[model samples]
Target: MSFDRACRVNVGLREPNVAFEKEDWAVGVDRGRLLVIAEHVAPGVPAIAAAVRSAPDDKSAMTELAWGLRGAGLAAYIDWAEDPEDVQEALNSLRSRPGAMSWDWWDDEDCEDCDEAEVIERFLGLAGDHSRRYGAILFEIEQGGDGYLVGFMEEGSVGMLVDNRSLRVVATGWQNRA
Candidate 1:
């Protein structure tokens, strides 16, 4: 089957019908898919499109865009206490699924016997480090035809794709699948 993956974020806008160039935002993103997602999350807002245009620079654009979305009630920031548990659970669950593979060598360490608590602790530590070093972290879960993909995109990273500043693919057992 053909690969299909989607990343969705809720976006709120003051002016739903504000006209903006969708193509100019998140350049690497699929416009058609974004349009559909925009329709579903906040009809007529085109939040991503607007934010990209409004941001000051390309390096900080995603961070600015995310903040703008959060301010408008479109996106959410992870609460380290509770959210990391859920994120850990998702990662552990993905490990059991077929075709699971670690995108980074560090993430491939032996953890077959690790319990929920241990997993969560590790995840929290990682999240903490990411936040301290990268300013903020944006969690993303992508559902694909083959499987699910998870990521922690750091604000310090350049481009839409993850780079040195981004968190390791530990939280996503099937990383880079998108």
Candidate 2:
């Protein structure tokens, strides 16, 4: 199991149309912004992350993850827009570096006994060699709160935290559990 320090949110309050003040996060994406994008995003590049984050596939968090990975010399999972519309421009920054490929398609054809930790070790090695981070945005549904959290690992250890109150984020971090 993964280490978890997740906290609860107050259920009675309404989620605000807020944006992350942190530079590491996507801008202009709160409740209202997401609603607007839900209608516009296509189905190709926005999948798993959308389900995890509660944001549409075209929203900021997933885009940022793709962008951040490519920008930092890592492989990008999606064939992002080269000159995306102003709204889609954020994803254009991360081009695949030389000798890089999106780790999403990692092959395990030769190792049936690889097990979970070995697979994670291999993924982490590749991510570290390329300076790429891995993470996911999961909604904390247990508390009946509309809070979304980023569970991530950038260059070192993993972490988990939620945006509380007015939806302001002080930081970000995630990786799928092995």
Candidate 3:
């Protein structure tokens, strides 16, 4: 079976539904650095969708807005969906499934003679170790040498609000997760 990522985040506001009315905003982080803070058409922050015309394909094209560091009082009220373990689980699934040679090697015919060490490393790269509360950030939407609305943000960095909550949240999260 294929893995699906259907995560969402709502901050200090009622979540937007498909019927209309998406008045929530979003924040993007990268490499422990704050980058772009934008608004969403729907209440879905982490939910992938278009800026205005949301569709399955529009997830990475949402518009961005300018907000200050910890200016929005949303850090405290932030709520998001479950952190995804899709890539990690998918890689592991290959190990338990029948007809699969091993989890450390490539399955495609192109890698018939590929190096074993490289193959294992590449396969293991799919697994991510994310913060328990802040969550894992594995992908970014970059094009033409920049991350669309998140150009200022780096790829694979955790997004966080620059408020007192960030310290407590991160500290507590790590302590608990650790």
Residue 95 lDDT in model 2? Answer: 33
TM-score per candidate, in order?
A: 0.30, 0.21, 0.18
Give RMSD to native, each candidate. Answer: 15.2, 14.3, 16.8
Tell me the tens digit of each residue's lDDT in model 1 across 26-104: 3333333333332333334566656555556542454444454445454444333443445544433431112233323
Quality of model 1 by C-alpha lDDT: 0.35
- Against the true structure, whose TM-score is highest? 1
2 versus 3: better TM-score goes to: 2
Instruction: Please identify model 1 stretches exceeding 4 Å from their true place.
Output: 1-43, 46-48, 79-172, 176-178
Name the best candidate (by lDDT): 1
Which tens-of-lDDT digit does each residue in 57-153 have in candidate 3? Answer: 2212222211121122222111122112332343233211123223342344533564643332233222212222123322222111111111111
lDDT (10s digit) by residue, model 2, range 69-100: 33342322321122112211222233322223
Supply candidate 3's per-residue lDDT for 20: 24
Where is the poorest 10-residue window by lDDT in model 3? 143-152
lDDT of 2: 0.29
lDDT (Cα atoms) of all candidates against the true structure: 0.35, 0.29, 0.23
Q: What residue pairs are clashing in model 2? A: 135-174, 151-173, 151-174, 152-173, 152-174, 153-174
